[model samples]
Target chain A: AQSVTQPDIHITVSEGASLELRCNYSYGATPYLFWYVQSPGQGLQLLLKYFSGDTLVQGIKGFEAEFKRSQSSFNLRKPSVHWSDAAEYFCAVGAVAGYALNFGKGTSLLVTP
Target chain B: NAGVTQTPKFRVLKTGQSMTLLCAQDMNHEYMYWYRQDPGMGLRLIHYSVGEGTTAKGEVPDGYNVSRLKKQNFLLGLESAAPSQTSVYFCATAEQGRNQPQHFGDGTRLSIL
Candidate 1:
């Protein structure tokens, strides 16, 4: 079984401020990780993914995440967030056994200007 | 190109009713997935297909049925809708490998009374 945990349910950040969302995953095998973003009433969009690569991976919309195997974490970060960056973000874990993504409860980001 | 398209963007159904949600992908993907999103629940996989004619249960598949008769289409059916099933449903497709990112549709908001 694979699972992802996002400790922050909701977070508010001032515009232009740095932001970091924590994600922890548990899987028995080597895991493939993903970060997805979703706007209200819309489906999820891929923010980034990590399979077998460098620990630090950059994604679109000025987002990045670092995979820390020792900590079992993949936390998403942004140097600066814009008003439009407010959305629901999810972290997922997958492996070759089933190839199914198990997503976390998500973190709601609110950017305050 | 429409990355992924789900039919009936919104629907309301009474308890015990049945309906099928259609998902089609233009990207010639080898994998397709169905997921439900609820507040504080993030996204839970309902069912998934690795290829045409193959369907498997995911994290949550008790109330859902899925079929993949064609490579480009996956259908999720709710045989007996319940209030617990009222949530937004999303369909996604991925390339042939485990590391490939999954592209998603706009989602279908299904409300069951």
Candidate 2:
């Protein structure tokens, strides 16, 4: 069965600090990877996705993710996190042209100035 | 623009109560999905629809029923609610493409007592 794992349950970072959210997946083949962010009382927004071609994919809101095929991981990163960047981050994986995705447990990010 | 919308932003229910969560999208998307978010569980797909009048089960479809009678609407029903069913429900939509990312709506918070 395909599954996504996010090791960190919570992460706290000071404003302007860099951020890294780890994600690992177990799938028979390379899957489409995605990163999403959810704010308080809000729906989730897609930060980025990795389908093909580039391993390092850039996304909205100054976010980026690298898909490592060898490690079966798609990690999200940001150079400097703002207070507004504080939100719950989720990692997901799905088959090519698949209908649904398998999501991780999510990592709650807290930005403090 | 209302990309996607889920009605009943908040609700409380006792065991065995039945309620339907409605999801509507105006983007003329061919794909609509329902997911449930829980503490330490990120988001799990409950049901999805590929187009009008077509519904399918997702990863965690148990205890939930769904319908997609109209092209822009998807409905999730909990026939007999349970405490374990308490979760924040989200609706998302995507164009019928191979690598399109989904757009989400503000989630509906449901608490089952």
Candidate 3:
């Protein structure tokens, strides 16, 4: 069985400040990792995905995440956040041959002016 | 292009009431899933379909039934609504293969009183 853990439940950051959300997963093999963002009253949108290749993957909205195998972590980072970036973010992991995904509890981000 | 679309964006049902949530996708994907989102809990899979006429239980598959009569449609039914079932429901679809990303719908906010 696979599971995901997001250490942060809520985070507040000022506009133009850097932000990082922690995510950890427990999987047996190389896992397919993904980051999704959800705005208020909207569906989730794919931020980025890491299947294989570069350790660091860039996503839409200037967000990026690095896959650290040794630490079993895939944290999402943004150099600077905007006021419109206030949303909930989730990290998910899928098996190489599986048909479903396991998602973390999610981190709610607040961008203040 | 409209991706995954879930019908009845919002619904309020009473206890013991039965209703069905419809999920339709135009991506021609091979896999579809139903999930529920609650406060402080990430999305938990309720049921999923690998293809037409095939359904399988997921992480949290209680008090719910699912059917996939067409490859583009997946229906989630609640035989008896309960307060615990009041949450946002999401539908997602993905192509058949490893490392594929799942696209999500805007979600349906179902409140059971």
lDDT of 2 by residue, B1-113 (tens): 78898999999999999999999888999998899998888898888888899988887899999999999899999999999999999999988764678889999999999
lDDT per residue (tens digit) for residues A1-113 in model 2: 77889999999999999999999999877677889899999998889998789899999999999999899889999999999999999998864433577789999999999
Q: What are the runs in model 3 whose C-alpha is more than 4 Å off?
A: A96-98
| Residues A2-110, model 3: lDDT tens digits | 7889999999999999999999999888888999999999988999999799999999999999999999999999999999999999999985433788899999999
Estimate the lDDT of model 2. 0.89
Specify the poorest-scoring 10-residue window by lDDT in model 1 chain A.
Answer: A93-102
The i-RMS of every model, in angstroms, reads: 1.3, 1.6, 1.4
- Which candidate would rank higher by DockQ, 1 or 2? 1
Chain A only: list TM-scores of all candidates: 0.96, 0.95, 0.96
Model 3, B1-113: lDDT tens digits are: 89999999999999999999999999999899999999999999999888899999998899999999999999999999999999999999999876888999999999999
Clash pairs (backbone) in predicted model 3: none
Candidate 2, pairs of clashing residues: none
**What is the DockQ for all candidates, taken in turn?**
0.79, 0.71, 0.74
Off by over 4 Å in 2: A96-98
Q: Taking the candidates one at a time, how many backbone clashes does each contain?
A: 0, 0, 0
10 residues in a row with least lDDT, candidate 3 chain A? A93-102
In candidate 1, which residue pairs get closer than 3 Å at backbone N, Cα or C atoms, i.e. clash? none
